[model samples]
Each structure stands twice: as C-alpha cells, then as structure tokens.
Target: MPIIELRTEIKASKEIVFDLSRSIDLHKISTEHTNETAIAGKTSGLIGIDESVTWRAKHFGIYQLLTSKITEFERPNLFVDEMVKGAFKGFRHEHHFEDLNGGTLMTDYFDYESPFGILGKLADKLFLLKYMTDLLAERNRIVKDFAETDKWKKIVA
Candidate 1:
C-alpha cells in the first residue's frame, strides 16, 4: 500500500475550489497529455456522492480503463472516491477542503495498492510512487490555476 498526500493553497472560496475539484470536464483538461476522458457515468459536470465515472486513458504507453465512484461527499468540505474497477489492485482518493485566510486549503490523500504483490512493491520503490506523485501534483496545479483565476467559470459556472 502507498499513500500520497498533497496540500494546495488557492486564493478562492472553498465552494469554488470544491466544485472545480469535482468537475469532470476540468479533469479531462488536466490529463489531456494522457488523452483521459470520461466514457460513461456522469461524463460531465460536478460529480456528487454515489456518482461514478469510467475513464479511458493512455498511461505508461498502455491504454487502461478505470472506474471510480464517489462514496462519500460533504459539500464544500470533503469527498471520497474509490476505485471500483481499474488497473490497480485497489485505490481510494480523498479530497478535503479547509478555509484559510479567506481562501481555500485543498488537500488530497491518495492511497493505492498496486497489483502483482512484491513486483508491485518493487515497482513502487523504483518509479511508480514518483510517477503517481507527479501526476497528482500536476493535477493539483491545474486545479489551482483554475481556482485562482476567472477561468474557473468556463467549467464550474
């Protein structure tokens, strides 16, 4: 099991940050390099509790399909999405938001278990961990970019 935690500061309201974070359209934008897209289940708009999305993307020179469901949600505060079906053995991503200096402090806690047991552990030690971390960081950067500017309106408004 591996856990990756990240905290990002955004000069915007929690509502805006929260909504932007859950916006499926924004996710597709952030992962454009991988050609990620929602192929089914709440393909557009902000996803709420109990909603699921199936994504198709190319990662590590291979194309994979992943389906995740929002199992928990608290408006403008927190949400949890767990992988129901994916390449990974199992994974859970929690999105948390807090108020700071009239802005929002967004935190991501991603925990995942890779497949193939020991081989997966070795891969994590070798490169998988960093690869996943960088991916999350870049995703957060894109979220921040939208949250800090008026650009968020195009997607979340």
Candidate 2:
C-alpha cells in the first residue's frame, strides 16, 4: 500500500471549504479533465454522512469506475471515503478541515494499491504515485481557488 498525506491552508472559512469539498458539482468542476460523475447513492447536491458516490473517469489511459462510501463524517471537521470497487486493490481517502485564523486548514490522507504484483509496485514507484499525487494537488488547488472566490461566498451565502 502507498500512502500520501498533504496539507494546505486556504483563505476561506472552514464551513465554506468543507461544504465545497463535499459538493459533487464542485468536484466535477475541479476535475473537468476526468469528466467524473456520481453514479450511485447521492448523485447530486452536497454529500453528507453515510452517503456514497461512484466516480467514473479515465486516468493514464485506464478507464476507472470507482465507488466509494463515506465511512466517517463530521461536519466541517473530518470525513473519510473508502473504495467499494474499481481498479485499485484497496483505496481510502480521509479529509480533514480546521479553522485557522479566519481561514481553513485542509488536510488529505490517501492510501491505495494498484493491481498486479511486482509490476504494480514498479508502476507505482516509477509513475503512478507521482501522477496520483499531482492529481490530488490539482484538485486541492481548484478547491482553494473556488473557496476563496467571491462567487463562492455568494453561492454559499
């Protein structure tokens, strides 16, 4: 298993950032390249505790359709989603948020494993890990930008 932890501060309220993070529309907007969708469970609106969503997308020439269930959720504080299906041998992502001097402190913890044996390990080491990390970072950047924008404030308000 490969684990990744990343943290970043955003100039937005915890509620604003946390709400945006759970919104399917926000996810689609942020990951436009993936053309992702919510195929099952709560297909729209803001995700809440115990909700699940399936995402279908293409990455590295692989068409992945993954379903994840929110195993843990605490409003404006923490949430965790674990994979139910797709290409990975195992996958789990935890998101955390904190109020910080009128801003938000966001953190992500992701763990996943690719298919196959030695080949999977090699791929992860050479390319997959870096690619996935970059993808996560880009997603975070989009959320940060959207959360801090006046447009977001108006929408949230």
Best of the candidates, lDDT: 1
**Model 2 lDDT tens row, 1-157:** 8998989899998888988888777777777897777777787778787888888887877777888888899988998889888888889999999988889999999999999999999999999999889988988998899888875753355
lDDT of each: 0.96, 0.86
lDDT of 2: 0.86
Report clash pairs, candidate 2. Answer: none
TM-score of 2: 0.93
Give the lDDT of residue 87 in candidate 1.
94
Question: What's the C-alpha lDDT at position 127 in model 1?
Answer: 97
For model 2, give the RMSD to the true fold: 1.5
> How high is each candidate's TM-score?
0.99, 0.93
| Candidate 2 lDDT score at position 46 | 83
TM-score of 1: 0.99
| Candidate 1: residue 43 lDDT (0-100) | 98
